[model samples]
Target: MAETEGKFDFAIDRGGTFTDVFARLPDGRERVLKLLSRDPQNYKDAPTEGIRRVLEEESGRLFPRDQPVDTALIGWIRMGTTVATNALLEREGERTALLVSASQCYPPLPFPCCWPCNNERISVGLRSHKGRKEYDLQRH
Candidate 1:
């Protein structure tokens, strides 16, 4: 095993059955580690343990129990998930909301539209709105 001191970049993928890690050490050496996913009776630590094991292998020392891994030398770490894909495949993720345009109702208005008197229930799309706001909302 070659040892170097500087910075490192790593990527980790945590899947349902395994965890894979790829790291680039300071000495320009590439390291790879794969571990089985595990969830004990009360703790889910597969991803974390996998990273730790990889780091230990690269550093040649067991990480301290009280302190976190030195992240300063870590250039970047990216994470991803297949939860949405799995949800779609399994027919899950049903929590969703639909936005109804006020103009889509009965008669279409040509000018600025006025929403019905539902002061207590109004959702503002912040993504579509911006700038300072100074106005009073009243149900009319």
Candidate 2:
């Protein structure tokens, strides 16, 4: 039977609260690294430092001294983010329009509603509104 050769691999995970890493070398040895997540700034620096440490430790574990490691191999990257949702929640979403039925244009305006307050709450097409009629909401 042919001798099975081992492989080297690395994995990093960044979550809302932590960063985790795992690395393995051809010699069947592995290393795990973890660090607390710092919001905003850490998002940029933590991964880089984690990768540097992994490389240093992996080099010593598999290729002691001046050994040339293979440079060609499979690599994977996966990223999940909540930045968009956060931005929207922060009221940074794009300007949006609301379409309300003409008849119910203004019903005392719900307090603290998601729709914009500065503009007319109700909007309808020319044909429909023309055929129908407009009544003073204040009177009704």
Candidate 3:
């Protein structure tokens, strides 16, 4: 009753202040766990610690002292980190992009609409974008 291990599929997301763990067992049962992204004593191992905690839950055992989950039984594992979001929030992300469109708009930009455009129905089909067959960018 204290220890269990089996095939599982897991996904991990490390946000700025939290680490989320989502797992699906071979029996079709699913679980989600969240842990603090940062601890007072250790900052570098936050993600690892969070994962270990989730694994402990999955195996129904206390980790480090108890046997860890069997990685070989894992079917798939996907993970994501918030380093990009953190960088952008801290104004340290790269700013390089080109946004171009092969389309047309009547009112033009930077102009105020008479609240008509604000209407969802009016705005949804506001753009009279022609069919793709006639789509082109000919700078005349």
Candidate 4:
């Protein structure tokens, strides 16, 4: 329960460049490890190896001889990875509509209005814009 805290805990963070693991013990001490990310295979394997090494070292230091850490002695084991790569590359974002003032209303799309949605491709009303506006629609 909340009153009882785990003796050992683990948490991980996976980023584009590296994977990080953080482990803490009831003794108010912690260990951190960073590993290079591997594509396709995910970034957990590397951190797992790192955590194993840390556990071994801690076990040796605490017991002096060969002793296994009891499961109950561990607090929590957390793992996570960053999976935003696809979304970043695809540029797939929220679906929303843009409202333009009457002065700069035009088929926002690069070319003329198509069909179906006829979704405004590109609208412009700003005077700073190089393109024509509603008033100069006939100019260009």
For TM-score, the strongest prediction is 1
Q: Which candidate's lDDT is highest?
A: 1
What is candidate 2's TM-score against the reference? 0.38
Candidate number with the higher lDDT (1 or 3): 1
lDDT score, candidate 3, position 7: 68
lDDT of 3 by residue, 40-108 (tens): 565345545655665677678565723454566567778898876577556564432212231433344
Worst 10 residues of 4 by lDDT: 131-140
Q: In model 1, which regions exceed 4 Å deviation?
A: 1-5, 41-43, 65-67, 93-140
Per-residue accuracy of model 2 over 66-95 as CA lDDT, tens digit each: 344343421433344454445445656543
Q: Which lDDT tens digits does candidate 4 get at residues 1-140? A: 34337466778887767878898866668898887766445423565555665666776644212334455656677777664644444545432233445445554433232122234444433343465322212111
| Clashes per candidate (backbone, < 3 Å) | 0, 0, 0, 8
lDDT per model vs. reference: 0.58, 0.50, 0.57, 0.55
For candidate 3, the per-residue lDDT at 110 reads 31
Error of 4 at 111 (Å): 24
TM-score of 1: 0.53
1 or 3, greater by TM-score: 1
